[model samples]
Target: MDNQFPIPGPSVPGEAAPLPTPEEATPPPPSYQAPVSVKPPVVKPSPIKIILPLLAGILVVGLLVYGITKFIGSRLPSESVTTGQTITLTYYGLWEPSSVMKPVIDEFETQNPGIKISYQLQSPQDYQDRIKTALEGQNSPDVIRLHSTWLPLFAKNLFPAPANSVSATEVSTNFYPIVSKMLISGTQVYGVPITMDGLALFMNNSMFQQKSLLPPKTWEDVLSAAKTLKEVDPLTGKLTRAGIALGNTGNVDHWPDIVSLMLLQAGVKLTDIKGAEASATLSYYTDFVTKHRVWDDTLPPSTVAFANEKVAMIIAPLWRAPEIKSINPSLSWQTVAVPQLPDSDIVNWTSFWFEAVGKNSKHPQEAWKFVSFLASAKAQQILFDAATSDREFPQPPANKAVASLAQNNPVVSPFVTSFETAHTFYTASNTRDAKTALNSRLIKYLEDAVNAVSQNQDVVKALVTLNNGFAQVLSQYGLVAAPAAATTP
Candidate 1:
């Protein structure tokens, strides 16, 4: 669907909000980090080693005793907690201040004084390794902050949001559809998101007025607009001015996600490793560079190009909006729900974070209680208000009621309206060797295919290689691996 919201002059014209810095939101999660290179990024491994068997046995015994103590402690009432009865629960969070979370955490603690919560913050890169190691050793935090796309890696160590705390029916009824889809498996609901965010097109208003062009509504319109807005050298046939940032890895922001948008919109079954639809989608996405010449290797990083007015359009989640504004607040731009595949059902890509309870927690029930409260409408509004104070725009609320009230917000309305149709995918962990990382090979190679196709490599062959690499990863994890095929469906 074409975003119905008209492009307003300037939403927040003055100083931009800096709640989520670019360093925080680049690739995948609403806090996505752009894969900055053709080579799939590998984060520095954590120094913690698996405990030795002798020590591990002792640790396990100690943890058992502690669990029993905490269980007994939890039996105490909130108003009746004494020194020995307080059930302290550890929590891990990313990208927000303690102050932001403190307000809600305070309320949760106040209502349940016996279950006191202790919070810790970690950088994303460090947190990924730290939490994984902690969970492996049974020292996992009581509650975890999970990305919608990252739960696949952490699922084994996490407890499903228990029915007694938050039922699957309540979850399905309260949050956007994607929330349940991403977090639920079989009959279990895994995590709950405090906010929801999906990719949207960020267009340069000055460029639009100068050329008298409306924002691109479909892929065809995008290509045509790319050609018209772009400037090229007559003799060298090299681009001097790029139209839209697409098809390349180093320059284009969130190219992996952009490819996901194309693949899903084209009805490619992403789980089918060797499907023909996957290859065709790759070719179509790369064609923006190879065929259209709208974007070239010479362009700067996408968000920068768009901010400097060197490009006309870029696709990113609402989180990226603050980044562009931080770079150049004076540059004019407005967001619209990402353009859809022409003549197809409306679809958009969403990537955001969620909170879940850890399986190993001594106080699993208490952890679930806090998680359920975090997803409630009352808590979500408090969350939105807190984030907005630090950011130019708040993350769209995941609560249907909360989102409905925000439907009038130009930036959020389109997203909230489209939440029912939004989709998400798993993000492969960047750690070199986790036995169960789906994104490690598939998503990274998907990025590699984009880089390859943009350089005029054969799209089929590239996809075939991507399929082969992806198959190896899937098979390693005991999943069924199929050979690549020539047909799209």
Candidate 2:
């Protein structure tokens, strides 16, 4: 229904209508122009839309973890092996620090999964005393670092490696000739060495130069040089500046070792205390103090006197160089192989240490395995090279092949030469049984003889006493049979 008034009004008054139209037009301006509805096209959601971000993030993180793990695997070769429960062994060491052992122990653990070595560093001074205590108890370490001189005393407490682990033939073939002499007794291989060491002559180069003397190569040369170099207090009749640190127990360090050198050089078999050669050797060692008066009890320990420039020379080991520097940094010294007997076959004493398994070890098999690794050429070489800092020389290489590697080193040259012809006489006991206990009372007996002679006691009487005491100790220990030596001197 439309209103009719609009058509009449449109013709009648343009002016009036215009006025009305203004309002009317404005009023009906957009007459039935109803808003047209426009709708946008619909978008369908993706299948994982809700979880896509979270899922993608997780996938990226997982890939990152996999990549990192693979990268780590590539870096550690030792971790390649699948492992079971770890076996931890305690190792006691007197000479080497934990820092030095760390590298090899870590590498070994890497190579053999589930094996851990707990190295306990010890002071060399208290090492024997402590180990002796540990051995008597149930809580002792699985492996121990034992000195060669201590072997005779501690051998009964150590576990002998089964022949298959370190056989006699292998010992003879792999190690220096001396190793078999000091360590292998009967069919048992008591220990394996990382490196070997022996007594060497530590000479004061300046003193030798001042006196215009050469390094002694024989007993007679040493005696002549000692006489020339010694300075005596005219009033006290005592040595003010000793020529050599020898001939006595109280004044000389390693007196037993010195006595051993004398006995071996003179061809006095330690097993034969009653022999004429034994008596002669005892007299000779004492004569330096009793007759020559080159060294006396008034001075400090041989090494101390040597360090203080109160003495001209000392017979010590490869380890003595650093000790000298530590005591007196300005001291100038040099080493030569220990002086041999005049015009006799060359011989030297091996005062070394080796790694061994404890007889009471809870993990004998695993402990032996670690010992085997220590004896390996690669390990020995690493040990030798690592030990070079501030030492007289790198630890003397024990492996026959390894020894050849360091043979040309000036400091090691003499030691290597000594290793070629070194001889050790462990007082052979009378025991025939393999596991019988044999004590090392020879060093004690030798010291007593040397001490007696230094006091101007009868050399013949001293020898007799030493022989009787040695026999009684041998009888007490039941060491009647000779130890099986793979190779002989």
Candidate 3:
């Protein structure tokens, strides 16, 4: 009744709220009023609550990614580990796949499974240059096969063998004396000699027999044979057959061989064994070509002349034996030490090749192991057999014992004999510049003397010119020793 809906109660301020105490304010419950039909408040989910589950899922995913990253990192090989385990080696191709090296390499692999090797074969001509480039680029192979002639050039680039890996004195004692000396630089042995090749006189036996002459034992005998071989055509005044082909350009790149042979024969120390002097023992060489007129440029190249039977003699290595036999099986040829100089014992040029370890190699130890195995007596024996049989081109074994094993093989005997008396050229600094100067200028001077004689230039004049040039070269390299106030020849 009284406009019946309850009026809003805010009309009274705080004083009206004290009107009733809790006991007096209790209102009697409406008698059995129908239950209120109140609906529950419509509640909506919070955006924050929904986002929390998604955040937890994202966190779990991130942790899984982190764990995976860590697992992969742990499994990768460490750089240091890789560095300690691998080695790479490089060598020039000595023989094709069918030769002695194949089995040796396979055997080495079988014996050492933990160590891995990578082999690279290069042409002999390009090997040194390639090695030099690799060394300069800091990518050098751990091991290399070096020519004995080239050892001096590359000695500086090699790493000394690890101490105690081999017994230095014992190893040195195991090789031929000449072979041993070639591998020594001061007290350090920079290389291990694997094989050697020495100069030998290769003769056409049939030609010698036909000429009613025996094989030459002395330079004089050779001269006589050469003289008899030359004849003049009555009508043309032209020479028919050359007595000898002995020039640098011909099949004879054997200038060092000829020079060393003559020098040894003359009792000249190729190098001042004491390192006191550096001089070319050119007199004998000059005399041989000029005095005898044995080498005339008029003849065909040595290879052609020998192949065609136009010339009867060639100074070649044991390696050439097979090729000579192959060219003419009926040629009836034999090998002998280089003809001795007058009043001198027989001597020849001995050249030995070495296996060296590169300075920048990652696997120097492994590389050295391979080299050592190759130089072992067993390997040397295999090499000797292969060479003697002509299955592979022969190189003299560095091991004297191995060399002696070939004594019974006729084709190898002369080479072995020559190795006994052979000597090598002394390399002063073992530098490219030094080698180039020696090979280009010094060698050329000798070649020029040969050329002059072949062209009929005055021998004395040529010798004097060569001497002067030699002096200039020595001075250029600062190799000239102190001049004695009074020097004796």
Candidate 4:
């Protein structure tokens, strides 16, 4: 999914307690002393002699206890406070099953010896709300799995990777440039991504071969191919086969990503997305239905349509490939980098989950240690290996070193290679943030804008509304859009 960084709110100081009055501070002095009434009473039998011996005995016992306690404490392991007792870190995670994560957790525990990972797989349904609740509650998990777009919601409640564990330089240097943009704020790194994913064009290889066509590389190429591949019933003027999946969010997965990509490719600043640049981009996206008529609302959802061979091409993240394969085991398909604007630098979009430590965690140090390990090259490779064993295709590793080794793999190469040019915004879908979530709320505005354009309405007003929605939602999370850099693909 999509994600961003955050600015923590200023802390409010507690009111100091008022000082006590003299009467309350001073207690009656020595009530045990005998009353020195006007007449002096006979002294008790050698009271001083009896008290001195008792005091001597008490002091001897106290010294003995102190020495014994010191001896025991000194003999114990130095890490006993944090490790000897064995801290069990509760990790709330999603997507990865126990089998896939057990190996990675086990490896971390073995190395640390003092930390135990209590990994719990979470359902994606209402995960943003659930996680937010957990993070704010008294018993939050030590580590949590969050979409990159969720940083704005959870940043204040999260513990940035401590210097002793993962550093800002390490994050920027090792992972995709987008990771730094999403997870880093100044000197603090908020989260560590285990995998990298983004939109890619999944095309039916057989369909292309039959038409003697190749995968499109630019907007012009995409249009031409869509025209040739699309099949329309001449008499009825109905679509029999869709050239590609686009135009409407109703049947399109990742429509938010597709729209954001078009905007970025056109150099429309997402923070202030309005004006001609945005209007033209939105029109072009909706035109796949309104003007070109290659795709329409009548078709099945993109993934389902592609699986059933009703569409020649669809844009989706690598994770969806497995679902498509399950739908049609015999279908011949290939993935390519998302099409870019002609004569412009390649700008790709990415949305993936990362591991973050809760600020309220009792063991923040140990929690970050485990998260840092998860982000390491060795752990990423292990995770990739385990995931491949448990499933057919896993999202490419976020670590560049690990991703580089997988560059030769056909299904993974297109996405892995696109990281250098990858960027992401909050308009990512399927993150399951909450009804009131930042991404979900922002997506609603975007959907409205797309629907307006597809229906041939005044898109400028829609764009204006969408831009305001972006600002409002981002401001709620204390975030202002940091525009992605213009880069050559």
Top candidate (TM-score): 4
RMSD of 2: 37.6
Error of 4 at 95 (Å): 0.3
Q: Across residues 415-450, which tens digit of lDDT does each residue of candidate 3 receive?
A: 877766666653211112333545456666656765
- Model 2 TM-score is 0.74
Candidate 4 accuracy as TM-score: 0.82
Higher TM-score: candidate 1 or 2?
A: 1
Candidate 1 structure quality by residue, lDDT tens digits, 1-489: 221111112221111011111121112457767668787789786545634666788999999999998998799787666456778989888777787788888888888878888888877665566777886666778888877655546777777766688887888999877777767665577778888777788888888788999988877788778778898889998787788898767778777667766676766645543455566666666677777778977888888888888888888767677778888989888887787765457777777788887777778888999998898899888877777777766678888888865676676666677678877655322223233355555667777877786677787788777767766655444343444555887
What TM-score goes with each of the models?
A: 0.77, 0.74, 0.70, 0.82
Note the Cα lDDT for every prediction shown: 0.71, 0.70, 0.59, 0.82
Better candidate by lDDT, 2 or 3: 2
- The superposed Cα distance between candidate 4 and the true structure at residue 437, in angstroms, equals 1.5
Model 4 per-residue lDDT at 250: 94
> For every candidate structure, what is the RMSD over all alpha carbons to the true structure, in angstroms?
17.5, 37.6, 34.6, 12.5
Q: What ranking of all candidate models by lDDT puts the best one first?
A: 4, 1, 2, 3
lDDT of 4: 0.82
lDDT of 3 at 489: 100
Query: Per-residue alpha-carbon lDDT of model 2 for 1-489, expressed as tens digits?
Result: 110001111111110000010111013465668788999789786678767998999999999999999898878877465566788999988668766677778778889777899998876554566787897689879999876545656766788886458886788999877787667765678888887777788888887898889888777778788889998779987678898887777878776666766666665556555455566666677777777778888889888888899988888766666767779999888788887654456667766678898877888888988898888888877776667653546667788777766776766677777876776544321111123223246556766876776677787898878867666555444433433345877
